[model samples]
Structure formats: structure tokens, C-alpha cells
Target: MSSYLDGGGGCRKRRRGGERIFKFKSFGENGCPVEFDGSFRNNVKALVEYGNLEMNLCNDGVLCWTFQLEVHRHPPLNVLLFVVEEPVRASSINLHCKHCRYVGWGNHMICNKKYHFLLPSKDTVASCFNCDETNSYESNPEKGKLNLVELKGHIMHGVFHSNGFGHLLCVNGMEMGSDQLAGYQITEFWDRLCTGLQARKVSLCDTSRKRGMELRLLYGVAYGHPWFGRWGYKFGRGCYGVNKPIYQKAIEAIQGIPLCLLNHHLSISNNEVSVIFSRYQALSDHSIVTLGDLLHFMLKLRSRLPEENITSSCNPTTVETNCRWSPKRVEAATRVIVEALKNREFRWVSRQEVRDAARAYIGDTGLLDFVLKSLGNHIVGNYLVRRCLNPVTKVLEYCLEDISTVFPNSEALIMNNSKAKPRNKITKVQLMKDIGYLYKHILNDQKPTMSTGVLSAIPMATRIILDTKFLLKEYTEEQLPIRGNSFKLFCTVTLRNNEGIDEGSKKPMLPYECVSFNENTTFDELRQEVEKCFREVYWRLRSFVVEAVANMSVKGSDLVVGSVEMGQKLVFIGSNDDQIGSEDSSGTGIVDCLCGAKEDDGERLISCDICEVWQHTSHALANADADALLNNIEKWVVIMMNLQRFYLGILHIFTCPVVRNNVKVL
Candidate 1:
């Protein structure tokens, strides 16, 4: 589909009125005689087919000559030198047009040697070019002369200057790229070995600090590599874009310091590092700042200043120091940490500062000591860290809060009362808010709805948490109800007035009654109501039979309810046909099948007494009754299936298409 300009500046000859005027252009160099292959028509046909364009070939059985000019020599096709790919099939054409030959302006010029021409795979040779046979050919096509300027604009934009791109897209604001930064310096190499830490820019008065970036940037940093400093620039230039080998090598170089060296005789265990991570679970739970960031910062901090007033104890009781960012914030957070530890609420602790302190005090091994200081114990810190690190659980918790807080703020979908209220009082604006609230709530609930509850259930207040902002909005707006701890906002109920259908004709009947319910009601309750509604119909039909056919033997007087199927349900009665053994003279007899039975004679009935008695042997739909329904089934099973399907709001079974005759069936 994508065609490149080729051959004689990609000149396309146009035909007028479905006819082409035969015209030929000539190329050669410096007084050399060139031969024509005498198959120009065939070659022209091949060219047309190859280019997927339709054109007619002209052959009046006369040799016509065009202007002769000097141009670069075209290369010969070497079949043995070519390696073909079955799928791509892009065979190399060795167009060795290094120099052109010019010959006299006679009708035909003769060369002393034979020249092999390189041609694209088309059977005909009509449009083929002839070459002088003087020179020996090699396989490589680079030997040919090329006009590089023609491809310059195609490869890169005219204004593309590497230095002009000021910033690279980041998780937050566009960060200054290496090209834009002084000396294009990449300060540190962060690899998989380093811990990932999260840092947030101080927010303005109007915006919240916890707002997430619209897009995430997945980056790997490695220390001490030549390319490390130019990562931003190289990435911007798209240099190692999707080439796996180049990208991997660059990534490896970025991880400058080998991970093995960092792990050498490290006193603190990973478990200790994990504890330090857990202390600030709420903040890190959403986007965890890796320990690597803190470790790197600590290393830089240590290098910046000589160790002074440093305690000699490996695990000192306590140390007071500035936080990672500011001394004032650190002091405030330290007090909170101490209080959190005293209260045994480990979730409130800040692990980043503690980790930095631990690394400084005991060479990263004292991380355990720091966590224990905040957590009060190693076991508790580990447990707390695990809980905070679970992103899935955290996301679910956030969604629940988001939904509950906004639920009361949602506008009502007024079905019954909306019409009664004046148009001005309809709260049209609230409708949009309600729709937004419902959309978010449903989207958030979709995950839990699809999942089995047992897997994600937690003892903590993991469910139904509300966002304070949304809660306040709901309170001020008077949009939703204060329903229990979870706000109960009223939603307009949809009233479905289902029509009945004809029995014999099986046509849909008109609207009989309306059904309405709260939007918040569970699906199971809805299913139960539908089952009950269908069961009423089933029972009514059974009663009709009991009254109409008194001659037949009857089972239990009471009706037994069965499982709720799609649209209909099955009911059973007491008494197996075999148990009664024979029909009693005083006992009842079956007059006719109440279920549209056919007559064998005018007076005599065709209904079997055994079948009538045994039809509903299961008096109760208990587990034991399953066996009775399984035995001695009736032809009406299909009808029951259809009825059940109709009741369940899904009745596609009756419309199943079957093949018949020789024609296809719908």
C-alpha cells in the first residue's frame, strides 16, 4: 500500500481516452553503445502488473527509438547472490548504475559484451532496460549512484533540531530532559536493584496533594554509565525505541553499579527494609516510593557532609534529625510517628524518614531497629507492611470511599414522582450529578461483583469507606439520604408493566401490572421475586387441571414449589403411579390431558391413569423430591422450559432455528 518513488524520478506516464501514446526515455553515459533486449512490451506488462496498475502495451512490430542520454549504469540481477525471505520476499536489486555511457544517435547501438539486468519478479520483459556488457558485476547494490537529497525530507522533518525539545513527558509535569538540563546530567542510575520511592511536589492551596498523574511513566535508572546522562535525550530522539537489543543494553548500562556490590555484607535484612516501608502505608500504599530512592538520597546526604555528632551505638535508642525534605516537617512527623507507635496504630507511621535514619545509623542494617521503633515489634511491622503493599486491596478501599461519599450527592432518578413534581423543581442539575455518581459506583462495584468475596475479604474496615469531600458535598447539597453509615440516596425506580400473551395463539398480551423496586436492591432478591411470580402462574395452572379433571387420581392436596427457573417453575404432588398399582372404581379417572391433549375417540379419553398419578410424584421440592421429578417425565417438559424461560426474562430457546429441506433455515 505504501509506495516509494523509484526509477527515473518516479515519472508516471498518463494515458488519455483509454489509449497510451508510446514514448520512451533513454539513459546512458560517455560514448558507450547500449543494446535493447528486444522484449520491451513484455517488460512493460510486468511493470504494470507489479505496480498493481492497469495499462495497455503497444507493439506495432516496428522498433521505435527515443532520445539517448548519458546516465548512471543500472545493476544486474544475480540470482545466486540473493537470499529470499518467503514472507517478505524483498529481494535485493543490485542497481550498479555507478557511471553512464553515451553512444551515437543512430537507431540502434551495439555493445561488444552481454549485460545482465536486475529486474523485479515479473514474468514479462517488455519494459526492461538494456545495459552495456563491458563491466563485471558484484552482488552489493550500494555500488550504484543514488540521489540522497530526495529521501532527506522523508526520513526527518525539516525543522527537527535535537536541542529544541525542552522537556520530556513525566508522570507529573514535563521534566527537563537531559538535552535541556545543564551538561545533560543524569544524577543517579536507578535499576531494578534500587528501591522505588515516591516524591510529590508541594501542592497549591486549591489542589490536593494526592491527585494522580493522568499518565504513568515506567522508567529504569541505573548508576554510572556513559549513556546514563543522555537517557532523556536518547529516549526523546527515539534512538533505542523498540529495538530490544539496543534497549536492553542501554537499560543494563543505566543500572551502573552492580546489584551484587550494593548487597555486599549489608547488615540490615530486606525484612527490616520492608518494615521501614510499611510505616507510611497510606501514602505509599497508593504509589509506593521505593526504598532505592531513600537509599540513594541517604548516600548523597552522607557524601555531602562529613559524619559529625553521629552516635556510636549500632542501634541507638533514638536519634533526632531533619526529615528527607525539611527539618520542620521532619520534626512534626517524628512526633506523629512516636504517638502512632505509642497508640499501636502502625499505619500512621512514616517509613521513609525512618529508613533513611536507619541506613545512616547502622549502615542500612539498623532498618529493623527503626521499624521496630515505630512498629514496636518486627512481627507487627512485617504484617502491617504486607497489608499496605497490596495495591488491589488499596484500590478497592479507595473506590468504596469514593462511591459512598458521592452516593448521597447523586440526584434521584424520579420514576413515579418525577412527573408529579413541577418542571422547575425537578432538580435537572442533580440528574447529571446522580448519573456521574452511579457511573463511578457501578464501575467500582464491577470488580467486586465479578470476584468471589472470600478472596478479597478483610477484617478491617475494608469496605464502604467514604471520601470526606464527597460526604461534605452530599450533606450540603441535600441530594441523597443519610441512609445508615453508607449513605442511602433514593433513586427513581423503573416501573415495568409487562403485558400478557394469548395461550393457544401464543401472542404477547398487553400491560397487566407494574413492577417496581429500589435500584439498590440485590439481584438475588429480584430473582426470587421473579421466581415467585412465575410460581403463582404454575400453581394456578395446576389448580385448573385439578378442578377440570376430577376423574383422574390426585396426589397431595397441597402444591409443592420447585426451584426458580428462567421463566417458569415445576411443581409436584404426592403419590407415585406404581404405588397405587391400579385405578380404583370409586377413585377418579383422567378425562383428557388438560395440557392440550388429543382425543382418541368421541367419549373415551386417551389420558393414562398411571401417567396422571405419577406426573407429579414429588409432593415437596426438597432434595429428596429431585428423584421423583427425574423419573416419569412428561412431553410438556419443553413447554415448561419455555414457560420458565419467559418468566426469567430470557426466552431465546423457543426461537431456535432448525435446518429443513434443501434450503437453509432461520
Candidate 2:
């Protein structure tokens, strides 16, 4: 567990001399384990400048943002979960956490448990927390501390305990070392006297004796070396016996394993695949419904495997039977699978792929039983589908609500990123339900329910915004997806000035709306939606979300959006007489803070003699460096006095001859 030392940041309450104190708290192993290091001002600046803005596009309009700061040592390791009221406001945000999760790389095999189980420190201080009086009766004075081994009865020696761990194991004939006998006697005698600290109901040896392959499943804590390989050799020394590859490989994988299909023991006999399919067909009588139902039932049984690290390019090893599966070849196969899925050529989930993942995660006994049960208690099907989903959008979904405006930045609790194996906890039915829930929120303007991922939300939002008009009609959850016939998606995809804006003859489009539609109404449609978001949303807003205060009267408009730029424009959309939409600015539509706005004085309201448009003097002077805006010298005299007045923050309109001649304010 990491512990944060002395740290500070640019606190809201800065000291008299402009000194900012940034304080952070790290939780220890008991609940708090953290450490943070960074420049205070630099940290605040990054968050304020580049944070992702998030908002709930519901009637109960909410707004918020997330800020991430990279640790100096590891760029991917982020330190703060800074959630804020608004993206640009640093002082009004909440600091969610002060520590970051470790990124366990360079290890031969990175598993999920790496994040949770930290190695015990050599300097571990053991004390009796359960006892009121921890002091010993003896005045030895060194009585407060107890050794970890003393507090916990004993460490369970695995199948083969060599070196430092040898004393904890008992052997049949080899003379028991004095130290080994001493430990065995103490453990057997103290089992009743020990507390609940390091107690396990049963030991691994009990299971290992009945099933020796149990050691193969301990790759997580194992150094991945076959320290127990010699123990298996005790059963035989000849090539006809345990010296064969079958006996040696499991132990070798626990030690010197290669990265290949054979190493994973995943290849199936060509006849095996046929046998499985034929058996399954016999069981189901070729009925698609029975097959589908069985598959569905079996898929739900899949569970997460912590030890597997699958990438986008991973595939089943069945194809590698004749040839070797090098990492490169495996990657190529993975790409082919992805492309096939993208093109909708065929729907497939590799049985071998699922099996290998289960093997990596489960004990040999459980793996065998799971495989058998998946095959319907017979040797029918061997596919594992439980933890099949991955966090593809790859980030947690966020929402903004009204409170004291507390923004808690919660980085993912899991340290593993996209490289980790996909989750098996969710099923297709559950995923579709989540998507449908969000879909209803998008079209009906109803409140959104919490979802599993931001990836799902992004495309749902993109589709909702892009297909607004088609969705104008009220829809039942069942009535959704207006399939087959193409409906216009008012897409906001920008075309360069040189490119054609109109889509020739494909679909008619309203000029103001940004939308698009597709024939696909299933989950795959989400992938397209994510693509659209990357192009339209991620680039435009950096990330896709905003602040929405619960119970706080959401202002600026009748409708709320997740965009700052769009929100600003929409706020002025229907305001016929709002101060910012006064008739004086007439054709200007809405004020462009970046450009400037005009007043209706009809005179001395700074006018560009060249372009003859109303302009701010400060803006004109600021752009004098550019040859275009303030081209000639004497032309400046026409608006010189008005420019200074405008610079002084006065909004008095001298006049706009374009719309009116009267000095309205005067």
C-alpha cells in the first residue's frame, strides 16, 4: 500500500503572500493506501484548462467535469479524481482521491490480483489489535510487538516446499529436519489456540493430494517457475512414466512457459470440434431454438478469469492446430476476427478462446466441471461466456447533479486497462436493457438511469442528437429502431469548405440539425455510434459530459445539452427579446464574444469604415496587426472616440445605421 508523504496544492484559501497550500490524504492498507507528487499550480492549471465537461441532457439539467493529472514517474498513472462544478473553474471542484493505482507492467504475466495483493513489507509491525491489553505479563519491555508468524499460526507449505519454505512441509521418508518437525508440531498443537487472523478452513495440500494439477492454477502467486516440477518426478524417472510432456508441461507453465497455443494447451483435435458440434446437434435435434437456448444458458455461466490478458487481436487456438501461433500470428488472427465482426460477415465467439480464458482463471477441478456443465453435463459444448464484455469505451460513465456541487473524481478502482480480459459478468440481455434504458432517456427527455459504461452512453447520445427528428414521434420501448427503411440522421459531421455539404441524393437533410441513421438496430450499432462520437464529440468537447445540479433550477433554456458551445448557442435560440438578443444586433444572430457585438445608437457605435459592420474598438485595434481588419490609417478616425469608450467597458450604442437611426438609450 502506498502512503502519501507531505504534499500541497493551490488551496482555495491561499496564504497572505499568495502561497497556496494543497493538502492531500492517502488511505492506508486498513482503508487508506496512497501517495501523490506534483507541482501545485501546474496541477490546478491542467485540470482547469483541459478537463472533460459532462452534463445530463435531461430536464433536471445537471453539469460537471473530470480532470486527470499524470504522475511524473508514470504518464498513464493518474493521481487525482478531481470532479468539479464546471470545467474551467478550479476553485469550485471536489478532490475525489489523492492516490493512484499501480500499473504492474514488465511482469511476465499481469493479472487482476496484482492490484489488490501488495507484497508484505519486511518492516511489517505486528500487534494484537483485538486485545485491550496487548502488553505481555513479563517486563521484557519488548512485549508490545509480536512476530507475524507468531500472530498467525503458520504458513501453508505448498506441494513442494524448497529453500526458505521447506520447514513448513512434512515428507514421507526423508529424515524430518529438526526445524520442520518443530513447525509441524507447533501448527498442529496451536490450531485451537490461534485467533481468526490467518485461518483458512482447509489447506491447498488437501485438494492437491487428490488432484495434483491444482498447483497449475496458482500461477498468480507463483513465480511462474516449476519449483514443484521435481515433486512430480518423484512418481517416475523413465520416459514411459511422468517424464513425458503431458506431466511436465503443467509444471513448466508454472515455471518456464512459452507464449503459444501449445503452451496454453488449447489446441483441439479436428475430430473434437466435429464431435462437439455433432453431439450438441443430437441433443438439440437440429432445432435452432434449442441450440440457441442451450447456448444462452451456457453463456451466462461464464465467469471472470483474473489471469488472462487478452488484447483486441486475441482469438481461439483451434485454428493453430497445424501451425504454430506466435504472438504475431495470433495478432493477425485477432485482426481478421475484428474485421469480420465489423463487416457483419458472421457472428462468432470462439469456443477455444473462451476455454483458454477459463483455464487461466479457474482451478483445474473447477475448469473441468465448468467445461462439462457448459457442455450440458455431457461432452456437448465447451464455450465459456460469463465474463465476455470488456470496458470498450474503456472509461466509467459520469453524471452531474445539484448538491453543494461536490465533484468526486473516481478513477477506475481496477488497475488493469483495456488489455485486461473482457468481463463475463454481463450478458447480452442485460447490455441491451442498459442501452434501451439510455435510449428511452435520449428520445423521451426522461431522466437517465445509471449504466455500466460511458462507451454505451456516448453513441446513445450521438444517435439521440443526430436522429432527433426521426425520434420526434413518441416511442414505446418496443416501437424503437424504425428498422430497414432509412430514416434521416441529421448528422453534424462537418465538411471542409472545398468539400460538398449536401449528400447528393442519399437522404434529405435539414440545415440546422445534426443527425444520421443506420439499418442496424442491434448492439453493433453502438460501435458506429462510438465512431461518430470520436469524430463529433470527443474532438469537440475533449470528453462527452457536463454539470447538472439536482433541484437547482437549471438555467439558460427550456432544453439542456451536454455541450458548452451548443448550450451557449441554444440559450439564445428562442430568446426574441433577451438582453443579448436585442434587435440592435439584428442580423448578427447571437453575439460572438470572440468577434464582438453591436449596439443600436446609429452613430459613434464603432463602425468599420471599410467593412461598414459595427465593431468593438478594442477588437479592431487588437487585429490592427492583421492587414485585413484595419487596413488603412485615416479610416480609424471614423471610430476613434467610440473605440476608447468601448474599451472602457461601456455598452452604449452610438448607432447602427443598418437597423435603426434613433439613439434608443438617449
Best by lDDT: 2
Model 2, stretches more than 4 Å misplaced?
Answer: 1-147, 153-165, 169-227, 230-666
Number of residue pairs clashing in candidate 2, backbone atoms closer than 3 angstroms, sequence gap of 3 or more or interchain: 46
Off by over 4 Å in 1: 1-220, 223-228, 231-337, 345-666
Per-residue lDDT of 1-666 in model 1, one digit per residue for the tens? 011111222112221244222111111111112221112221222222212221111112211121211111243211100001111011113111101100001111111111111111111111111111111113322211111111111111011001010111011111322111121111221110011111000101111111121000112221221122222212211110112232333222222222222222121332222222222221121322322232233323333433342311011112346323343332333333343333433322234433444343334343344333433211111122221221211211000001112113222112123342231121323322332332232212335432333212111001111110000000011222233332221111111123422222232111111122244443334333333332232211111111111112323332212222122211211111111111022233332332221211112233354665212222112122222322312222233334333432221122111111223447
Location of the lowest summed lDDT over 10 successive residues in candidate 2: 110-119
- Clash count for candidate 1 is 52
TM-score of 1: 0.15
* All candidates: TM-score: 0.15, 0.15
lDDT of each: 0.21, 0.23
Worst 10 residues of 1 by lDDT: 466-475
Model 1 residue 611 distance off true place after TM-score fit, in angstroms: 93
